[model samples]
Target: MKIVLPTAGKGTRLRPHTHTKAKSLVHVAGKTVLEHIVSRLASLDADEYIFINDDENGPQVMAFMAEKFPQLNCWATVQQERLGPAHAVSLAAPRINKGDDVLVVFNDTIFVTDLDRIPQLCADCDGLIYSKEVEDYQRFGVNVVDDQGLIVDMVEKPDTPVSRLAQVGLYYLKDGRGFMDFLEKTIQAGETVKGEYYLPAVFMNMIRAGLKLKAPTIDAWLDCGKPETLLETNRYLLRDRHHVHGEATDTVLIEPVHIEKGAVVRNAILGPNVSVAAGSVITESIVRDSIINADSEVRAMILDGSIIGDSARLVGSARRMNIGDHSLVEMT
Candidate 1:
């Protein structure tokens, strides 16, 4: 089995940070989003990984991967056009073997689960999809399954959905043939909406054609789509702060905070939940429930529920900003 992970999107919503590194490189809980995915997938029977990146930061992603996960055989493919997820998977066709099982995971979704059991679970099934019970299905693709847990239909953001089971960003395919064919047909037939082909349509076609698909609800999942949601995800994952690194001198730290090495803190209150990356300095500051990336500085400020990027300087700044890496701002 292999895993196809797409990290090519422009990530316009996660500005500043995305401006420099791939969105998958965004750090959460002392690890990048893509790193979390690869680590989880590594525990499975996955033979190799296919990482799809864009022209913007493809080399950087490969460099990061080499430094971090040298044991895994990771192959990188460039996507000239930033199409939908289905299209992104199509680019992996040349690398993927026919009739081989492949797991397609979204780069931004930080899933916490026993992934080692997923390949075994899906081996007996034709395809497997993950779902979650959401209050509102209008914003996500909804899956309608039969009593036997076999998905019958999937409606993308249906106004009136039969089930609140929303599609999470995990999919197991027995073969990538149908997925690639679907993308080609959808694009050739000119059935695209808003200039992008959707992956749900492929699943819908497969379901209608009598292909068995299973939907297994996960225990915990986080969508790092927007700034607020990203912050929430970090807080939720920070339940254990033992692994977080930070040097404290007369500093008070609350539970669930990650202070990386080379970060110096003095007389500062850090975290009910927070992540301060390496080389960052925190002095006489109050940081709670936030993510501070590498090489950032915080002094004499109250930072709550914010995402501070690398090399960012915050002094007496209290404004809520989703800043990018290496940005400097001084507050009085």
Candidate 2:
């Protein structure tokens, strides 16, 4: 099966970090968001990997893929216009064969599931959409299933939700050509929410044409779109994967903290939930529930719920901050 990753979004919510690197490249729990997603799908034997990316960070993403996953067949295209998710997926059509099965996933969302089961679930259907039961269904697009347990329609952020199955950003289509046709038709129809075509709209169109879409449940759907969600994902990953390989002197070590190799810590109280990247230094400080990127330094300070970017320096006093890469901030 071919894999399609739509990673072209501007990621305006992620701000300064996104300014320097793609949102997928943001580090959390000792690895980039894209790395986390790729690691989870490493077991799946994908025929090709197609990435839809923006002009600014597209090259960087391709380079990262080349260095990390050189053995895989990877292709990337620049999405010149910020059309939307459906439009992004359409960019990969030229490279895909008509009869090929496609696995479409968004780059910013990480899901923990048995990806091998997706093809089996799509055996008797035109497509399979992964979903998780969410209490806040109004915040996301959802699948409206019929009495027969098949997806009848998809509603995006409904004012009054009819179902709790929130559509996670994972899709498996048995027929790539059929999906491309529906996507093109959806774009031609000019049917959009907020002037952008959504992938769910394409699925809805297919359902109207009598195509079967099966809904599969996932174990966990972790979103990294915003600051809070990113931190939550970091905490979730570090709970079991956290490790420390750095030097610490006169510091209080907390469980579930990941201090990467080359990091130096001294006279600090660090984490119930924290990740200190390689080459970073923390001295005479207290930190918790945050991510300190590579080569950054925190001195004589107390930080919580913060995201310090690469090569940043934070010193003096106690406070929470979101410092970007190569930045210097002193709290008086």
Candidate 3:
């Protein structure tokens, strides 16, 4: 099977951070979001890896993957117009095997599932979707499933939802060409709203064509789309670590803290749910429930539930701001 990772979104909700870097390249806990997803995909028997990214970030992505996951046969397609999810997938159809299964994964999602169980599940269905029950369905693409776990209906961000089984952006296509044909039909029928064609419409088309669609419940799934979501995901990852960091320090930690390698923390109360990425310095600061990205310096500041991006400098200042990657802020 081939893996297609769509990372072209500008992530407007993430603001200044997305303005500077691609959403998939956002750093959390010493690794980029794309790196985390690629590492997970490496566990599978993937024959080819296709990356769909925007023109602005294509070069950076190439250099990044070249150094990180060079073992895999990788190729990239540029989405020059920033059309939509369906259009992005259509750009890579020529590279994928027509009759083989293709796995479409969103770059912002951190997927954790039994990779070996996917092939068998896809054998009996035209398309297989991954779903997770969340507290609220209005914030996501909800799946209306029957008692037998079949995805009978889907509504993307409905005003009034009937179920909380949100689609987690992991899809298995038994035949890549068949799915593309449905997408084409949706376009021809003028079903697009807001000039963007969503992937859910394709599923509706398949249903109209009498194809069976199934939903598999996932064990772990996280969407790192916004800054708040990023911080939440980072905290969830650090929940079970006595000493999450690989590096050592004479400074004391208050438990449930993650200090990455090469991080120096002295006389600081780092705890509860703090993630200090590699090459970051945290000294004399009380940090809790936040993500401090790599190569940044934090000193004498109270960092709580904040995201400090890569190469950022935070000093003894008490002022707090929603900072982006490669920023510098100092206390006067």
Candidate 4:
């Protein structure tokens, strides 16, 4: 089995923080989104992990991977053109072999599912497309399935409520070469949704060819693509945490907080959903529903729904922020 992660999006939604590092590198719950995804997929013990990234930061991403997860056989490929999901994943076709199990995951969201079930789930089907039931079906592409849980069709933000199973951009295919073949056909045929070619078209081609895909629902789908969702995801992941690493002198503690052992916290009120990464310092501030990345400094400030990037400094203010790495803010 192999894992293919299409991570070429320039996360404009996350802005300032994304301005410095890749969106997947932004910290949340004391780990990068990419780290969390890799951790989640560690259960598969895949033969290799392939990342298709934009040309500019491909080396940086590979460097980070080598430094953080040297145990995994990881390869990074450049998606020189911002074409589409199918095109981005096509970069990994050279590594994926015929009949190999391949999991294609988009890196913008975190999903809770049992990766161990891939063998049983794909035993009778060509692949599996995961989804979560959502009330707001109009906002997402959804899978239309039969009573047997076989996906018959997929619709992208339909005007009518055809299905409630919103696609989460996770798929496991038993035929790795077959998947790439369909992707190639779609690209050569210019089958596109908007101006860009997407994966659903490839899936449609597969379905039209009598390929069967099962629609499995996941327990949780946490989106980390933007600040609001990132804070919400932080809150979700930190719900069970209520501890501080060092002594908090003259400070109040709130439930669901994760202050790292290397971080410094004093004279502040922290919590009900906050995570301060290692080497960061917080003093005389109230931080709630926020994630402060590594080596950052916050002093005499109040924050909520904020994301502080690595090595950032904030002083003399009380507001929500999306500060990037190496940023400095001092209010008069």
> RMSDs, each prediction?
6.4, 6.0, 6.3, 6.3
Please provide, for model 4 over 71-160, each residue's C-alpha lDDT reduced to its tens digit, 9 standing for 90 to 100.
999888889878888899988999988768799999899888998988887889999999999999999999999998899899999899
Supply the TM-score for candidate 1: 0.90
Across residues 175-283, which tens digit of lDDT does each residue of candidate 1 receive?
A: 6666566557766766565777677877777776767888888777787767887888888888765554568889888887787888888889988878888898889
- Residue lDDT tens for model 2, 1-332: 78999989778999888888899999988889998998888888888999999999999999999998889899999999888889999998888787788899898789989988876887778888999999999998899887766998788788896888999999999998778888889999997888888898899888889899988899999999888999999999887765888888898888899888899999999997899989999999999999999999999887889999999999886567888999987653
Query: Poorest 10 consecutive residues of model 3 by lDDT?
Result: 241-250
Sort the candidates on TM-score, descending order: 4, 2, 1, 3
Segments in model 2 whose C-alpha atoms lie over 4 Å from true places: 317-332
Error of 1 at 173 (Å): 1.0
RMSD of 1: 6.4
Mark the 10 consecutive residues where model 1 has the least summed lDDT. 237-246
- The Cα local distance difference test for each model comes to 0.81, 0.89, 0.80, 0.88
Model 3, position 306, has a per-residue lDDT of 86
Name the candidate that leads on lDDT. 2
TM-score of each: 0.90, 0.92, 0.89, 0.93
Worst 10 contiguous positions by lDDT, candidate 2: 116-125
lDDT tens digits, residue span 1-332, model 3: 88888889778887767777888888765578889888887778788888898888877887899999878898998988866888788777777766767889988778778877876877767778888888887889888877866778998887886878888989988888787677777867877769987888888788878888888888888778888888877766666665655554566677677777777787677777777778888877888888777788888888788888778998875555799999998853
Name the lDDT value of residue 70 in candidate 2: 89
Looking at model 1, residue 74 earns an lDDT score of 85
